[model samples]
Target: MDIQAVDRVGMILALFGPHRESVTSTEAADLIGLNRTTTYRYLNSLVNANVLTLREDRTYVPGPTLVQVGTYAVGRRDVLKVAAEPMQALARETEITAVLSLWGAASPVVAHVEEPPRLEVVVSVRVGMQLSPVAAQTGIFHGFMAGAPSVVRAAREMDDADRERLQSSAHATVRQGYAAQVSSRGIAVLAVPVWDTHGLAASLALLTTRDVLDVETDGPELAALSRTAETISRMLGSTRPAMTG
Candidate 1:
């Protein structure tokens, strides 16, 4: 294999991150330190191979082949697989609904749910449900995670009071390594972050009635939840230390 060629391809791909979604041949050439003619040749080759798609304006975006390969890679090593056993054990231990939510393009979306065996009352959650920044404790991702698009969207939609409260909650979540909130219907929601090698990969959450579970900063449930989240994070290659309460 040509190591130099592979490294150059990796460099080109690394240019696409966070707010950057597209690149032109000229921009890629300048950023990657290549000559214009050489950059055009490389970009054209990538377009022919479907690794990138060239638009009318000459900007290149990730093509179908790139998207397919990315999706396949995530399917094999995503947080869902690493968190599954820990989430199931947490659900059973807490006797509450355990949820694994991934940070989506705009908000946290439910990726998985585990219900305790033989629970009389179960909180209903479905995969693909978009959790609200105001209504769901998982909004901590928007508040605490850097470069998330949902933060701007949430700030625009909230009033002064709600925004202040969310900011406060987000700060506390960072300090304590978890977020806790209660809904209008007296259901308690507690969430902790599950990190990967990069950063926060997902939120591990528990949902139960206020009577069934007390939401506390240093309570037993919070400790247990944090432990479970840490277990999953370690499995996903996170080296960050756990938050101590």
Candidate 2:
């Protein structure tokens, strides 16, 4: 492999972060420290190769081929493989939906979902859905992923107050091993971190009605979730100590 070619490709990909969904050739050149002519050539070559898409506005975004590659990579991850059975059992035990999410370009994306039977009004979640980075529920990722600081910085432009809230939420998630939020629709979501030897691999979450998660009554449910996450982490060779509330 030609080292220069590899470096150029890597730089091109790195230019597309959570904040930048699309970029013009000039912007890409400036960001990557390449000349405008070289940037245009590289961008066009990527577009031809289906690694990126050129928009009508002359900007570029990740294309179908990148998405296809990402989906395949997510599917083959060991964490998802180990999480399958435990996630299903979690949904069954709590009668709530179980979600497995991974950090993506701008936020957490659902990598897998399992819904419980006999739930009259369960929340609907699908694989590949992107959760809001600013939402309190996603603090689980912010607290654990090694790339979390960069992700947070790129996901959205925020004021000081918003930054403070995000920091506070992340700190709380670190202390409790999980994060919880009530949706506007009255659905409550609790999420726990799943670790790998490399750091945060993903998040395992339970989604249920607000009424089902009474603080006084859901102790066992919370414990079960934590244990399940620890089991998954162990399967992935994580040696981190178990999280405690």
Q: Which candidate has the top score in lDDT?
A: 2
Candidate 1 per-residue lDDT, tens place, 75-128, comes to 875787778888889888888889888765445767789999987779868776
- Model 2 lDDT tens row, 65-97: 987987798778998888989888888888878
- Global Cα lDDT for candidate 1: 0.78
Residue 82, model 2: Cα distance from true site in angstroms: 1.3
Residue 111 of model 2 has an lDDT of 84
| Candidate 2 error regions (>4 Å) | 1-43, 53-64, 146-149, 215-218
Off by over 4 Å in 1: 1-77, 157-161
Measure candidate 1: CA RMSD. 8.9
**Per-prediction TM-score to the true structure, in the order listed:** 0.66, 0.75
| C-alpha lDDT (0 to 100) for residue 66 of candidate 2 | 83
